[model samples]
Target chain A: MTETNQAIQLNQVNYSITGELILKNITHSFPTGKITTLVGPSGAGKTTLFRLCNGLISRDSGEIFINGKSIDDYDPLVLRQTVGIALQSATMISGSIFDNLALPLTLKGEQLSEEDANKLLELVGLEKSLLYRNSKDLSGGQLQKVSIARTLVNEPSILLLDEITSSLDRVSQQDIEKLIKRINENYGTTIIWITHNLKQAYTIGDYTVVMMDGEVIESGPSDLLHNPKTNRTKKFVRGEIE
Target chain B: MNFLTLSLSLVFVFIPIVLSKVLKLELEKDTIIATVRSVVQLLAVGYVLKFVFDSENMIYILLMIILMIVAATHNARKKGTSIKGITWKLVVTFITIEVVTQTILLGFGIIPPTAQYLIPISGMMIGNSMVLSILFLNRFTAEIESNQDAIELILSLGGTPKQAIHTQLVNSIKASTIPTIESQKTIGLVQLPGMMSGQIIAGADPVQAVLFQLLILFLLLTTAVVSSALLGFLSYPSLFNERKQLLKKITTSTSDTEKS
Candidate 1:
């Protein structure tokens, strides 16, 4: 199969749980080297969509192509390493931060020297002193950062963030947003960020896709927030309805 | 004696009900059903054991050991559902422990291969090893399943699956062996172990019986630890495939209930 120019391409993707469609027929393409924010309310299937891309959940009917090849062609383990994900509820193993960060690389059979891990920690804005600390002892924000660092340890081509900063304070949120931007700009990593915060979406997303009831309502450049064609999009962007 | 029997029967019948009611447990029916089943099974086995003991046939003794193996297999399978090749694994465990303990006993001339000596000693060793196998397998399976991510994390970090689960396996073996160790410690102090008391009643000298009992306890403790650890290590590999993904198919039907 030939690779597509898009980082991730979904064609007629449909997912349901217990016969209720969580994500309806959806077709979209995420461009390479760009930050795309999937904005939706709760139950809008944002998380399910992430699962579909990662092959954690199978679609009832649809095809997902990662980097132009069918997702089925890649082993799930390999796919996970290539397309790293950070969950909203960051689950840390009961171990030190160094262990957590080294997990993906270890699982992928990649060599991770101490210096490499230390450098990755610094990239995620974590100090070398935090490496020995137990992951459970870290605050929510610090843990999220650790999760991000762990996901990036393999240096995946694409990164998926599922509401990673929704629980953070203003300072932590801004700090992570800056780190994310730097990662995208410096490493040229494709980013798919899911969030409910339209302000954050506008601030960080190069492209924005707004979804409701398992369907994409509108999608365009981030600047399209200034001139939304759909009334629902306008209402959502203006906070008139959630 | 009749009064004693009547009082004993009454206490046995009503004590369970009183305890269940006091504890506010909703398992009255289950408890009663299980108790009845246990009583019937033990009674049948008791008579069969008596016949076997009297016959003094080596074949009958061997048959009894086979039966013990089957029972142990059932118990081990029920506890470690994820274990594949369960029957063979359990048989290996049963045979290893039984052979080792019996050989040492007979080699030392402690129990002259008599049906009386063979049956009870074999029973004790088999029963203790069965319980240990169940404990070790159950704990090992549960720990691996619950801490799967941690295990995978370690594996991904260049640790082999065996290396990743080594600590958990050791912990499980230790957990299963502690009871036998404690029982050994309390022998002849807080409580008389069954083998020692039975030997004394069967016309053996008290001091000689004590020495023999200590030897049996040590043998049982060693067998239980080795067999349980071996079974646990052997069975755990079957839970995951060559690629290290957890196999979803479990052998035992009761596993779902235990997992929940």
Candidate 2:
């Protein structure tokens, strides 16, 4: 948890499944207390890299370190608890909203009280009255908010978002963006946002990294939108090309 | 025993198949193929059974029962390859049930080791056990794979792996055994059972055949429940490693393509 420890570190990571390389030998560090957005075109290995960090998928070679410790050193259960993730397809289980939000905590053997559940609901801009509703009945945007609240229930050190707002309307998308900014600013949670939208990335990201065909093409502060260093980055920002 | 009646019965086997096709659902081919295979295989066994009944050799009856158990085990193993050491597990389970049931029947002097008692009773038990094991194993494996994330999430939150998979495991066993229970309950009321009808056709008194069928059905209920429960409990541990992490390699799904 030191400044040099880095919230997440990928070192020469190369991942392949069945002879097809999905992620090349790419090295990067997600520094603590900052939001890093991984922007790339379709099939650019963004989700694969996120899964590797969360320990959902294994890497064929190289190592990933979180908080100065190699991924192999930590148990998978511990890694999941420390690094929470929300899938692009925000799925809610067959349960009430309270049960959905309290799932991580309940599994951890912490008895979930009504007050704590209400507080978590309020954090996501959801009213306390909605806690007892069926999770499947929630709107798309509401489900994503509940999913984020569930991810935060255990207070993970790093939160990995994989196009969480891609399926939402503009207003819902903005609501999620504001929520993400609040979570990062108030809780000091290291955020790794993966998206194809340049505008959203420019709005929320502190450090923006552009990936294309499994390689990092360019990376800099969010101000790079004003003066992009790479032609690919500029074209992508202007919607001239994918 | 007329050819016309037997031909008519063949048409009856198509009821479930035709219904499924008209509904335009999946599993139509599997159902048809399974039904056809069962008919052909059982017809061959029926011929062999006629010969065995005439000979009335105890060794022949015992061998036939053993063969049925072996076939049942093989079928169950094919469905649950994810459960490690499945061959041995199947053998242990079927053998335990066969020995226990055979002993109880023989002790009561129901029909001695004659073909009359051995073939039909063992056939009913073996067939029921096979169906039960297939249902239990398939459901168990599918449930585990589908709910893997939820299970892992629970484990990370402090639930033991056994505790995490408890609901799914129980649900699988319950689902597998419920049909047998339901059929047993509705036996003489809703439908005339196969064994009872067969017995009455072979010149046994109706009441006596009903009693025998009832006993066999009760034994089947016990055997199916016990075997399914045993299979689920014993096979579940093989899906996880010593450190309690799920082993992804142990999947019952045979296809190489990964499901999203």
Candidate 3:
């Protein structure tokens, strides 16, 4: 596929820390407006890749294009605004839910009205009543919902989720999955979700990318999870490698 | 007091050392070292102060102030090692504190231009600012470590570096400054301030001693705010890179290692 169709393209991307290479010449094209799940073992550098994509960490030597434009061409702040990220550790600032949801705009010296905050809460499957409640009082599931809501406040074109449902109960996980699917269908937000659950990767992703030791093993249609071409991808799907 | 009188004061030191020994606290060694160091250092400073006073030269006064600042900066900089260029940051903050406090004190004719007034007041101001800086740095680093998730949350949401660290910075400033404010509330009631008691023991009138003590008390408030707020502002920018990425670790001595 051409660069025009790809939301993000990493070409010969390399990253290292403390003289140890974390990512070694990673190259891939992530299609726009699709759910792409990255699956791998614990130290696969999945989260680091997302950080690099969002410009939270710079690549050592490589080029990453966002929507056919060089990632470096965009201002870091604006790039982050364009590409929102949410971590699994759903921490809340010591304030009301409204404050947490409005934080992105607040940082930009703009005010988010109560009505708009309520809309975000509603969109996240949270009660509009929760808007004025102290965020620290939220349950784990509620916190994650609010975290996603906060990320959505920026109206990002691409969403990077780092194990957002890893610690939740079954019901919460399913609810989050449904919410995410609805978000993708409605908004067409290209999402790169990092998950360890094979079932989740197979079920939720339109495309599945397998990573091992900082290299892409295989990426194909999610249906390929049932019959992957590479032995590594098969072992990964069979729960033998991890 | 004469040398004999000063030597007699060692009895107070012995009391602490004896108590620690009886309690098996293992603080006796530390106490002894502290006592010895205080005696030697203070005596040296005393002689130096006497020389500066006797000389009555502007250069000597300035030299004494510089020495105080160097000592203060060295002592305070360790607490803020996570801040880049912390050595220079502390120096700038200390120098600014000294200038602002002294400018007001001398500018308003509240104190004399003599070394007697200038040296001691500068010592107290810089010393207090140093303590405040340590307190601020300690709390700031702790806040950042504990709130790393929250800070990155803000950054990933397109918040500026200053915006991302805003909550931690404000909390640190408040935490450091509160002790100064609270201690002043009880001032004379809670305990005799050292400066006031010293002036009284040296044959100054009680009212005059208190007035001087109030001046020092007021000066400390300024030191508390200026030292903490200025250091916080200067240190936060170093916590992020040009891409507005929150460094996984912020340290002055080494580059940050990103969280894999």
Candidate 4:
């Protein structure tokens, strides 16, 4: 696919820490306005790859392009503004949920009005009343919703999620999944989600990429989970191996 | 100030030793070692100060200051083992504190340049800043370890490095400097500080001793803020790699034991 059609493109991307290779020459393109799920076992470098895409972390070698431009071509802060990321267990500063939601705008020297903050809260499946409540009083699920709402305040073109539902209960997980799908459909926002659950990847992913030991093992449509092309992918999908 | 008077002070150590033996606390060896070490170190410093005073040479003064900074950096770096290049970061901050404090003292002619005055004042400033450095390192490392996700969350949302660590930096600096500020608030009422008491015991005028001690206290306040701020700024970048990635090695295990 050409760069113009892809929201993010990686060509021979490599990353390492302390002389240990984490992502080895990864090359892939995440299509614009689609949900791409990255699935792998622990230590497979899926989270590291997300960081590299957002420029929160740099690749040791090769090229990563966002919107057809080299990642290095844009300032990291600017790149991050365009490609927002949310971690699984994020912390909120000691303040109200409104304060947390307004942080992105505040950092840019912009103000977020109460009406707008409440809008974002509703979009994330949280109540408008939660805005004035102290974030410290929030449960785990509510905090994650707040975090996701905070990330959306930037209006990023692409969003990267790192197992955001792993720490929540079943109801919270379903709520988050619905919210993410609605965002992608309503806004045409490109999303790259990292998940350990093969079922989740199959259920929500338009395209699924399987990774192992810092390499992309196979990448195909969500249907690939059932008819995996490789023995490793079959074992991974079948829960026979990590 | 005489040898006999100083020797009589051993009675204080003797009391602690006897109490430890009677209580079967087995702290006798530790107490004796501390007493002996303090005596030897102070006596050695006293002789060195005398020599530096008599020489009246600039190089010797500068060398003594450098040695103090080196020793201070070595001590403070222990608290921030997770930060890479921590020794040099501490050295930079300690040197900054030394230069700024000494420049003020000598430049404004607040006190004379003679070793008798310069040595003791520099000692107070360096000693206090060293303590502040250690406090900053401990708090900064702990805050970063605890708030790693928050910091990354900030960074991933277009916040700059300064913006990302700003809260941790402010908290660390505040935590490190609050004790100095609180003590300053209660300076005279809480207890007579050692310098003032020493001067009063040495037959100095009560009012003059209080004035000089006040100057030292003010200097310490400046050292507290400057050391905490400078160390906080200098040490945070080391917590990240060249790629701006927060290094995973910084997390201290829950069961990790520190030697000191």
Candidate 5:
């Protein structure tokens, strides 16, 4: 892809821990303003890649570019602000839901007015009344919504999701998927989502990237990935392999 | 007190050792070791204080204060070695606590600026601060381990290291200081503090001893708050890297690592 077409580009990315190659010789580009689903087996290094993109951890050997600029060019906190992430289980600070929603601005020594905070809650498909409620009082689904709204408070151009809906009920999972699509459409955000659910990956993502055994096996349009050309990809799609 | 009278005090230690032996509690060895160590250490400190007081030298006073700080830091930093540079952070905190408390005491003539006056008071402040530091570190590290995801969540959303660790840091500070605050509330009604009891036993006026004890209690209040805050602020930055990510659990603290 052309540099301008990519929101993030990784060149020969290599990462290891304790002599185990978690990610090896990876080169990929995530297209601008599009949702890319990263599907892989349990040990495929999807979370590690997300950590690298957000500058939470350094890669062993690689050059990563965001918006055609080196990730190293941006300050770490600034880079994180540009690329937000939500974990599978939402962990809230000890405060009201509004405080959690307003945290991004609060960290910057600014305040998130009630109206703006409520707008964020509404955007995430949660009621504004939850603003004054103790964040810990929410259910798994509500907490995940608050987590997404909190990430949106940063207004990141890129959002990395780490199996956020995997543990939720089917209804909550669908709700999250719809919310993610809405977020992509309304903000034009570049999203890199990781999922173990093959069907969900093939359907929800605009582009699908398949990974297995620490390597990208194939990538293409989601429709094409459903019936991939490569035998490895074909095997993965048919649930014949992890 | 005479050496014979001090030696007689060893009987009080025997009661615990005897009880442990009868109950098969297996605490006799530890109790004996603690008794021996305390007796030796206090006697050594007493003789050293006697010489320093007679010399009336400022350098000697400074050395004694430094010695106290070194001992306190060594004990306290063991609890927080997972915190990067915990040794130096502890040293700075003890020094700050000493300076702040002594400045108020001497600068206002609350206490005479003599080795006799300075060394013992510095010892009490540094000793209390060291205990407070240990409590804070224990609680703070536990908070970090349990709430690591919360800290990372905040960091992922553009929070700085300070912002990320703020909740754990504040909570730990409050937890550590609570013991001191609660004990102070029931000071004389519940228990006569050791210092006041000691002063009265030394033939000091009852009212005068209580006043001195109150002064020490007030100094401890400062020690509790200052030690926790200073150590908390200093230790937090080291927990995160320049990338603003929380570093792995501090490896140097074997006990904390094992607990986790």
Candidate 6:
């Protein structure tokens, strides 16, 4: 909410593909060192917004600022390094799990120390011995956890997660939520999470933003799920409408 | 062999056509068409080669080489119809391979600058590079489509475009080059190649024919590696734009999006 505490800011951001507009005139800001959960129905542009935030896809028009600097001013690679993103499905590099985890550092010609690698493994709820195991042998939960660990290797300031827990079992989902909360609380990492599950969003988010048809419907405190300001948010949060 | 003996080889074509008719394979027309086309095409080429050899003009030789490269580019571009600028990309790749191979051969005095030597060897080089270009394009586009998220993930992690498609590029290069490697490994024991057998049938020494065939095979191996790597680099930038953003075509490309 305050200028100094803002981690990411979007001013009238718009994007499209093949003449079909995706995100339209979006304006919002995420506070640093807090969790902002994005809740919306399918095709509401949550994923596209995440891609824009990290420079995976450029915006058609409008400006994005990261930590008070225009995104285009920084090198695209440096901006991405500062803002890490993890997708729903985990795709491992063809190597041991350790290699996949260390890739972020490896691309910069840096190697992860054995101690740091094992520490990340334990942080993500995997055993250190799994480092040497082939990534192909990992289960879905294990792979997702490893993916999160991989994103964290660079110590990004802002982390964007796009429905990473949707495909996992309840236990794995809870484990991921806990890990995310721990990261925010302990490391002061700014987190933006997109999720369809209202309960999960209410449980972990310090702030919540609801979107519909490429436009933001309502954005406020976590209690916005229970005490929505608008009729569209009411219908969405009450499960009366998709 | 005389014209009569070569004409008798139509019996081989009849054998396949008759079998297809009897087995209800429905390939008789295709077999007949292939035989007729090859007969017409080879005879035309034979006369053209004889005329070109008689002239011995450098212009004619270069024209023939350019024609071969253009034909090869057209054929190879079919495999990557979804890629933007694919036709020109194949043109660049094929021309580079032809020029490089010819420069090496002539620059080193390995082969004389005569139509007889230049035409056949350039044909082999262009043909081999064409196949390699096609193989690389097919594998590269498929890899880009299937592993799109992985590539975007790498980009989001601060990796460059080269770093993003590194795995797919390597895999494609390896896949395209393996055929050349495996065939060369068993060249002598498993099969007698076309040029060597043609020479032997024409009464050339066995050792001399083998040596020429070896030279062709070596040139083919070099073209295979160079074409795959060159095409991979040329085609990958289309997957991402100048802003380092992954284009929509990375996942699924339509004819509509094939234009830059």
Best by TM-score: 3
Best-performing candidate as measured by DockQ: 3
The lDDT for every candidate, in the order shown, is 0.78, 0.80, 0.88, 0.85, 0.86, 0.88
Window of ten residues with lowest summed lDDT in model 2 chain A: A1-10
Q: Can you give the DockQ of every candidate in the order shown?
A: 0.13, 0.15, 0.63, 0.40, 0.49, 0.50
User: Residue by residue across A128-183, what tens digits does model 1's lDDT show?
Assistant: 99998998789999999998988887678899898999999999999899999999
The candidate, 3 or 4, that scores higher on lDDT is: 3
Give the TM-score (vs. native) of candidate 5. 0.93
Identify the runs in model 2 with alpha carbons over 4 angstroms from their true place.
A1-4, B1-63, B76-119, B137-171, B233-260
Comparing 1 with 3 on lDDT, the higher-scoring candidate is 3
Q: Candidate 5 - CAPRI tier?
A: acceptable
For candidate 5, lDDT tens digit of each residue in A87-194? 787888879998888888989989989999888888888887788999878999999888888888888999999888888999999989999999999999999999
Please tell me which model should have the higher TM-score, number 1 or number 2: 2
What lDDT is reached at residue A122 by model 2?
90
Chain A alone, TM-score per model: 0.96, 0.95, 0.96, 0.97, 0.96, 0.97
Interface RMSD of each: 7.3, 4.4, 2.3, 7.3, 5.6, 5.5
- TM-score attained by chain A of model 3: 0.96
* TM-score (0 to 1) of chain B for each candidate: 0.81, 0.79, 0.95, 0.92, 0.94, 0.94
lDDT of 5 by residue, B87-143 (tens): 999999999999999999989999999887899899999999999999999999898
Candidate 4 lDDT, B133-239, residue by residue in tens: 88888888888888877887777888777888999999999999999999989888989999999999999999999999988888898999999998888877776
Clash count in backbone of candidate 2 = 2
Candidate 3 chain B TM? 0.95
lDDT of 2 by residue, B52-85 (tens): 9999988898899889889889888999887788
* TM-score, predicted candidate 6 vs. hidden true structure: 0.94
Every model's TM-score: 0.76, 0.80, 0.95, 0.89, 0.93, 0.94
Better of 3 and 5 by lDDT: 3
Q: Runs in model 6 with CA error above 4 Å?
A: A1-4, B1-3, B253-260
Candidate closer to the true structure by lDDT (higher is better), 4 or 5 = 5
lDDT order of candidates, top first: 3, 6, 5, 4, 2, 1
